[model samples]
Target chain A: MADVPTKTARAEWGTRFGFLMAMIGAMVGAGNIWRFPYVMGNNGGGAFVLAFLVLLFLLAVPGLMAEVALGRYTNKGVIGAFRDVVGRGGMVGLGVVVLLVNIALMSYYSPVIAWTLYYAVHSLLFTFTQPGFEAEPFMLGLFDNAALMIGLHTVVMGSIAAILALGIRRGVERIVVYAVPALVIALAVMTIRGLTLDGASEGIAFAFTIDWAFLTYSDTWIAALGQALFSTGLGWGIALTVGSYLREYDDVPLGGGVFTAIGESSIGILAALAIFPIVFAVGIEPDAGAGLAFVSLVEVFPEIPLGGLVAILFFVGFFLATFTSGLLITEVSVTTLAEETRFTRTQTVLGVCGGIWLLGLPSAYSVDILDYLDFVFGNWGLPLATLMIIGIIGWVMGPERLRLLAVNQNAGIHVGRWWNPVIKYVIPTVMLFIMAYFAWENFGTAEMIGGMLVLVLFPIIGYALMSVIEGRGEQPDTADLTGGDD
Target chain B: MALTAEVIGMLAFTLLAFWGIATWSLVRTLRQEDRKVEILKHQDRMDTYSPESLAELREWIENNPNDPLADEARQQHNECVDALKHTDMHYYDWSSEEIDRLDRV
Candidate 1:
């Protein structure tokens, strides 16, 4: 029997230009700049880079296509899409996890964005020109002043909310058109600047240099796979959620590939340029963890002539990067509201942003707790959530049917037939293995494993409870996972 | 640290705020859905029988028996006066606007 074809409510993009830029902005973020270089340094640089590219082709892009297709077809947020196809119980589990992760993300993420604002203002005021140009002092200057940090963070959050409040077409898509391109230009400038520096050869060498032996370590592969997924914003539901707004007529598979490729390569190159030159110039080790972005780099800023200007641009760029990620993070929650409530666009925006703001406090104030939470949510929670998304859409969606959806989405674009195999078997298997491997590698100690499980599983368990409360007990329709095409 | 009255008060206030928003949104959603459902039911009932209408109605009833107007059509079909002979589309005429409206809702 032919089901009635309802009008698929496609949320309009501000423009085709806005659509492209916003998608790219969502894809590019701090991971490309702050996280990529540091992780690359630790792993074998060239070898890790090679495997990462391969993994992106094999697992990440196809998985991304499935998500985009699901979102676009269903025209709903993560939970709404999941529930409509998978039933209420399946949805609750996914929704609660997504909500918790977005909340945790904003908590510390806002503070980091605040840090960028602080640096931007300091650079503009030429505050760093004061004689004492040392890392400890500069680092102390920003973090110690909580009030300053809080104010800037608030300003950044306010700007982000104001833009989101304008609705998707005007606010996000329009602003991102400029923001993303400017970000790319800034990165290019930084890369050129790095190359001109006296020690830039070393910086270039540091990035491109290979450690083939390092590839032998399974942990390196695991890290590379995770980085590929997380850095591209795969496990986050941000891409899928945003892509849900796209019209069915748009070529989704092509959009997915282009977004993923540009995001990965640009961020990869920009991160290398931004970090390696500074690290090489200062004689600092390239492999220092998260601290490299904040602590070590600020120390070197004072010696340069236009140190303040450079710092201002660098941090401003970071702010944009984080802001892009943060907007998507907030969007995940806002979309939940759009699906669950009849609140107008404005109300839903405020509701989600405000909710995140309140939830964000604990992480902002405490680094140690935030670190623990970040590990649990970013590393473990996101992968688990993404795995569910893939399985729900891939296997449960009927393999043949899902392939047809993929083909339909790729009508004008050329995604080879091989995409089906990757989405169905290769991607999910790789994700599962990496997730398990990371869990094993990180959770070695019994106490550590137990504590991590408690933290991560609490949200999952709570979601299950919510599902029972709201769901009308029904098995998820594995056959119709893309919520059926009209 | 031990729980204090201040902390308890804050928790209570937060809970109230969350509950208030959730309840407000839920009511609004349910109301909107109800309005849409009512419109759909009305359209389904007002539709008449024709050759095209008979085919479409038969398909709709067969596929969507749970739809609100399905019972009305069932009663009409089962009426003693209009037994097997009048069941065909020749007995009734339907307007394009009516059919379009039925399709819309």
Candidate 2:
């Protein structure tokens, strides 16, 4: 009798392009569009770029490679990955640490996506071009109207939930392949338009002028470090979760590490080109904060030629950037819970999105709550997740094992021994430094206190919860901790 | 206002470093994927590791035979060796002499 082939029902990316696009879409958020440009505008523009590039190569590149390799090597989501490494005990709680942080981040981030969605709709209406329109009051009106904010938040979460319910190929991959390219093209068009404007060179000079002094300043490095790490969404479990769905014969190092690290950040450079030239051309005082995108850019839209069309391109692209991130950020939880629980994918989507929406209410009701959570999570929670994931790969599983097993397996570019030390020593050290530096900078403040609480409380909560479930030994551990297992 | 040569130079450097490298990696990886798919269509399986990486895997398996992942690594290394000997086309550059020298762990 002839044996028939049996294909597993496992959902993988339909194509390599879909997987690549998903990484870019998940990493390039509203921060890449606005926060990066904002920081660059303030720091010596060219100097900041120099600092950022150095750190990106040293830390984010190798670090991301390690994170992606661990995911592909294990082919599991956060918690399962931890169990695979640590032999199915309380130590598996480390994965829960990552999951909790991912959810916490999405809770506030979903509301921010809602903000962009609101502006994207208005930009479609050419609201920025309306007579007697005020950018400040327009922004304030949205921020102040709690009902509208909550409604927009609900809408954003609903859209994300609907997309996620479709599963990986039909859901996330289908949207990102189109959305990511559309985002790049939109920014590219805006960049061309901005560059051709009068006084555009002044904006360019303001942004690209290398003050050699900034390279000497610690503050410049600090700003660049923050932009490089946070802006790339390193550790956050987004990359790991995305990496988990990698198909057989997929290369992790090149696509997941090099391409993703540099590719998503390239959008930030595009953003600076798109926004600053337009701002200078209109003689608007450049504000290098979140306000620049929401308020300052809105003001400039009325003054430029074909400004209404520009508004459409910028806001729509901005919405795509944040919305895709929202989808993936929430997917980290959806992927993990769906694995751990007996629930269906559709059920997981509803449960995760509902939880995010509920946690997001306070953030949705007020901008202050959003900013507060952003600082806390951005400073401590994310680095903690990074520490957990990279720490496990570095110390527990051993970087050499993962590198040989996954990183160099069909890798586009060969990664040498240099990556091991970076993963083992460099990344964890940098993560610790980032958390400590931020704490020292904001010492004794409420934000600092909140960050401290997260650092302490999250691990305790994760350990206790996992201990109760796993200590009972309801299932066999079956953890393969051969070579490199510490 | 006239632009300084320094600012222009910085802008050029940043653009080349970010977008230039990004475009290169994206194109290269996608091309690699295409090559892999084409190879798999012809052969049941393609070589999973390069010469250097396969050697590294073999060395690792030899050095740490007791490691939990050693069996998996050895299997991967041997699979690549088998594919190299049997397949006409290869993903990584491998000479017939190199294929002859290969052995299962």
lDDT measured at residue A482 in model 2 versus the true structure, 0 to 100: 27
User: Which RMSD values do the candidates have, in order?
Assistant: 15.8, 2.2
lDDT of 2 by residue, A1-486 (tens): 245522224578899999999999999998888878868978999999999999999999888888888778777889988888877777788889999999899999988898889999999999999999999998999999999999999999999999999999999999999999999999999999999999999889878999889999999999999888888888988888898899889999899988998999999999999998999999987875558888999999989999999999999999999999999999999988888888888999999999999999999999999999999999999999999998888887888889898999988888988888888888899899999999999999999999999999999888888988888454536455523432
lDDT of 2 at B86: 89
Worst lDDT run of 10 residues, candidate 1 chain A, spans A477-486
| lDDT per residue (tens digit) for residues A1-486 in model 1 | 356522333466644445556666776666777777777767876666767767776777677777777777667887777665566564557556666666667767777677666666666776656665566666666666666666666776787789888867877877787777777676677666665666766665666567789779987887778777887777567766877787534556545554444454455656676668766776767655346666666665665545566666676777677787677777777776676667866788887777666665665565555566666666566666676677666665533344343334322244545666676777778767766766676777543474467446845664676567666466554323443221
* Per-model TM-score (chain A alone): 0.88, 0.96
Residue-by-residue lDDT tens digits, candidate 2, B1-105: 999999999999999999999999999999999999999989898888988988888888888898877888888888889989889999998888988999999
lDDT of each: 0.61, 0.89
Clashes per candidate (backbone, < 3 Å):
0, 4
Write the residue-wise lDDT of candidate 1 on B1-105 in tens digits.
Answer: 232454344334422432333334334433433443454454422212233424433454567566434564454433312322333221224444533443211
Candidate 1, pairs of clashing residues:
none
Most TM-score-accurate candidate: 2
Candidate 2 residue A414 Cα shift, in angstroms, is 0.8
